[model samples]
Target chain A: MREVILNSYREAIRDRVLLVVLAFGVAMIFSSLIIGPLTLGEEIRLAKDIGLGSILFFGLLIILFIGNRVLYRELNEKTCYLILTRPITRFQFIAGKAIGLFLTILVTSLILGIIFISYISLLTGSLQITAFLAVIGVIFQLTMLVGIVILAATFLNPFLGSLFTIFVYIFGQMIPRAILLAKFYKHLAIARILSIFHYIFPDLTYLDFRELLIYNNPIPLERILFGFSYAICYSLVMVLVAGLIFERKDL
Target chain B: MLATFLFQRSIPPIYHHSEPLAFLPSGPMVEVTTAPLGPISPEIIWLAAIQYYGEEKISGGKFEFLTQVFDVLTRIDPLFDHAYQFGSIVIADEGRSPEQAIRILKRGLVKNPSSWIPPFYIGFVFYIHLRDFAKAGKYFELATRRSGAPEYVYRLAAFAYKKVRLRKGSILIWSKIYQNTDNQTLKEAALRNIRCLILEEYLEYLNKGLQRFEREKGRKPEHISELIPEYIDSIPTEPFGGAFKYDSSRDSFISTTYLQIEKIIAYLNNKLHVFKQKFGYYPERLDELVAKGVIDFIPPHPLGRIYNYRFGRVIR
Candidate 1:
């Protein structure tokens, strides 16, 4: 599993898309710095807001573009057979790949985050712990995203897998709201169906601490603990499900 | 290259003859749809709102959808303080909807109870635009209670109370500032305003008592304390430590503190005369001094009395 994870990481890092995404993300941060002064008096705020946004967006690009294709390409190219003949189980392979993808996202977000935080510090003449924590929040969100994409890639073609991943990502964020809406309009059947999805889907809003950054308020310890616990468990469940599907495939 | 340029030039520009923010979804829908983007979504929408406001200003059109655009933005990012702050101002001053401005600022207050800015802006709209000084004083007082509120908000709160002739409320806020501030200058300023407010309170109390006594007895009271048990509960202590006197010629109470009130009355009457000279008629309202740029704000009468505009003169 260690070897597979390292191999997956190396393969993902070598992809040109990673460089393009990182470049775009950095460019976005710079653009934010340029536009920051134009947002009236909210210079630091706009810079930090746009910087965190750029990290999340480019990170999502990497996930949807690379993550949904990596496992599917490996199976189609018979690379899994080469790995499966060794000591690695299908579960270990899928889990390793998901972990590697998460690491890629984590590193990518950190690189963007450092530039963001450094720029914000330069502008404000102080270190921004809120910006740093917001980056951590983005990393947690991407962790769940990586797992969902890996699970989708196991069952669907790459194109459909990416689409399915995006759908789940969007719907996952709206899970609480979907349930509320269903109940609001008095649709009992729809409410029941959405309630099932509520448990099945990870509520991504749990990982969003950016709004709390505005007040410079410290995010409570319980909330951070819950976000970490939920992200890891949800990703583990996704990898476990993908492993089940991948283990039964004839390929 | 010339053919391509010509083709581009010949292409008809897509003119938007539609209203701004017309296609914006409801706040709840925008909230759910933009939920995935987190705070980024509001920033984008806020940029769009700024552009829309600029275009509306340039085109001289009513900002028909200003409220809805900001509503969606704030709903998506409730902590988006700039959207609430800037948006409410544009909605009130340019969009001409002080009520909508208050609603948006109030929404911001719900999300950010610790922030003084939203309440301060709400107070400004009430005081400057709607001229509802009581509500203005209420919100300004709320703002002064918040953490990190500036000393100016205390002054604004006191000033707003005085605008509505609520001298007691004005005195309380000024007294609070006088007690809390470490700045010697501000302390002195607050102390001065408090004394003025207190003197105004006492004069009004005595005058109202004199009126009630005259109304019942059908004759003027010879002494200032004659109506104590019936008209006033007690003769309040004079603010200047001087005794009140009954002036039979004018049929009103008098004191050394009346000197300050007399000066203010003379100044306002002179402004009224100037307005009459310039415009050939007295302003129907005293705030016309502010509207005509002769004064930044209507000066509060020292006796907590509303100035009545009559026949080219201001009488308190």
Candidate 2:
């Protein structure tokens, strides 16, 4: 298990994809300072908006692109055979890789988060503490998405897994609003189905901090804790189910 | 996950029916036809009235219906920010009910404690339309204390307080802004406007004294200083580093000494007109006109307060 963890960490650190995503995220944050003035009364608002948006978007891109490529690259290069010959279990290997990539995302997210917050403070003469809490919330959301991608990859090729994960990410963000819309249609059957989707899907909207940042509203601590718990529980379930599926597969 | 899969499969496949009900006569039939067939559940009707109230084509009875609908919408979703904004603007600006707008905005604030937009609009309505500057200043102050209130709002509140004669309050607020702001143009503008306001108040007192003198005497006063015993506490000094002068010849007042040149020209023209009106020819000398009683007292030129007993004639 220790060897698997160390190897996964090294693989992610050596990966050039992480570097590209980090550069893009940083460049976008700096660009916000230039774009912010054009928005009239919302200068600092636009800065925080573009900065936070870039972090989430570039983080997701890195996760999907690198995460999908990791396992497939190992499989295509026949490195999985060498790893399997060792005493390490498949579950340990997958868990270590997921954790390693999660750490990479956490490091990158924090770097961008600090820079964005500093920029906002310099522009507005006040720091937004809520923005930090919001970044953590978004990280949890992405973690759940990473789990879903790993689970999908266990049962399908990397390409299909990445596509399915992206679809889930998009749908997950819309699930809450979708459920509300379904209720308005007066179709009990449709509402019931939507409710089921709501419960099963990891709601990314819970992590959204754009409104709070733009409007300077304080975030509720209870909601943040609840959302964190939801993400953790959902990701654990996906990973465990993926383990069960992988254990039964011939590969 | 299994529960969700089972629920999806449990509903009857009505969507797959060959003959769909197209022409539903009654509401119940429409409901039945539109009901979700498979595992999909029907959408819930959450505050349907809100949608109807937002329609722009509503008029007369429809407008009244919309108000009721909005009330229902607010009751259902008290934290709906957009509803409060639209409803408050409609009631205050269009309906001309500042009281109703205030009540609605207060209710919205209670539900959404973090919102600043409602408080900003509340101040705006009171300041601009109702002209209740005191209430407007209070609301604007509250908005500034909030997290998202813009910087310009603070300046506006200071101006409003000044309009309502809250001089100390206005000066205090503006002083704080002047200290914090780095924009030279904005700072200078604020300082200049405040000075002008202070000067205007003193000017008002002088004009009121002049008016009281005229009311008592039944004609315009000969000089502003003559009202000192009756209407004024003491004669006010000129504000812009100039002294007041009284002209006995033209029975007029002037502020600065340099205005005497224009005053002499005006006095000469007036005496010429009087001479022509009385004797049908221009007066040969200023004293000749005074001797003839064509002018009991030669009024001073309107510009200069110093008497200028000069003679002149009109060319044509």
Candidate 3:
């Protein structure tokens, strides 16, 4: 498991595509400073929102386009055939990929978050602690996203897997809001089906602290802890489900 | 290059008082476009709205794309409190649509039940611009109970009640403002309000006494002092130490003024505004006040003449 993790990290870190993603991500985050001047008095807010939004966007791009292909590349190159014959299990391979992708996302988010915070503090003469919390929140959300990507890749091609993960994210964020809409349904059967769908869906918005940063709204200490625990717990469950499904694959 | 691209797009086609057509396909349209990106869609829209706001101001007091962009932003993230604040100002102050601004703020208040700033701003639009003190008081009272609100929100609430002539609802808040503030200008402002409300209170007593005297005598009193002792106590002194009078011919209660001529004109102008709001235009003349039974005769000016009504203003 440890060797699988180290190998995955080394492989991703050496990829030229990862470097390209990181470059664009970092540049996009810094571009907020240029865009800040266009707003009336919401300069800090507008810039920080764009910066944080860029980090989230580029991070997802890496996971969907690059991260989802990690497994396919291994299989196509017969690296999985070579590695699977060793002591490592298929679950360990998928888990390693999830963690490695999460590490890459964290590194990219940190670089972007730091650039954003520095630019904002330079502009405003004050550093907002909420900005970092927002970054931390993006990292947690990306963790779950990485899980969804890796789990879906086990069952489908890289393109289909990325497409499926997109639905997963959209559905994940919309479930809480959709549940509120369920009451408007007149039929009990329809409401009951929607309730079942709502219960089974993952909610990604709890990890969305970006708005909290924009508004300077404080998230209580306990809720922050709950968010961390929720992300970790949710991601572990996804990994567990992936392992159970991938362990018996004929590959 | 980016600016040119947006201008070429010319935003999207929109209909007046219709479902908003966002230049960028806002709210649900934006949500669908950025769905795969997660909740960051609204933040992206917020940034775009900022850019749009910066660019569209070249037009003279007209924001063709203003409501479309802001409406979509608010709809995308109803929790976006600052958008509500800035949206209302842009609509009210710049777009010349105070009613539209109030509508936006009211929806924001409903969406953000715990927020005080929305109600505070709503109160201000009614009080300062619309001069609908009752409407202002309703929203300001809502703001008073919201957490994280400033002390001034409460003061405005109190001031609104008093401004609408509900003098009893205003006393406690005015007293609080008078006692708590150390800023001389604010203290003086609050003190003046308190004195005005106090005079209204005293006037309430005098009015009841006059009614009693009229009922007993079957005619108006001959002298100002006739209502005193039997119908009331000593005459309540004017808050600014002026005298009171009774006019038998006009059947009017008159209060003498030591107020500046400008203030007197301002006071009469405010009454005229109220009259216009009621009758849909300025009264044909000050004597119309007697015909409408609003007052028995014209209020006296400090210059020993009637207020010079010119072009809808009572000038010196």
Q: Which CAPRI tier for candidate 3? A: incorrect
* Chain B structural similarity as TM-score, candidate 1: 0.50
lDDT of 3 by residue, B36-103 (tens): 55545666666666555543332111355677677777766777767776676556644556787787
In candidate 3, what are the lDDT values of residues A1-251, reduced to their tens digit? 77777777777778888788888977776675676555444566667777777778778888887777888898788888888888988888889877877887787778878887787778779887778888888888888888888888788889999998878777777655555545544555756776686665557677878657776667788888888898888888888888878887787
Best by lDDT: 1
lDDT of 1 by residue, A104-130 (tens): 888888999899889888888988878
Local accuracy of candidate 2 as per-residue lDDT tens digits, B266-312: 66577668778878876544445555776555443232122322235
Candidate number that wins on TM-score, 1 or 2: 1
Q: Clash pairs of candidate 3?
A: none
User: What CA RMSD would candidate 3 show?
Assistant: 12.5
Cα lDDT tens digits, model 2, A119-174, are 77787788778678767876887788778877887776877988888777766765
- Who is ahead in TM-score, 2 or 3? 3
lDDT of each: 0.78, 0.62, 0.70
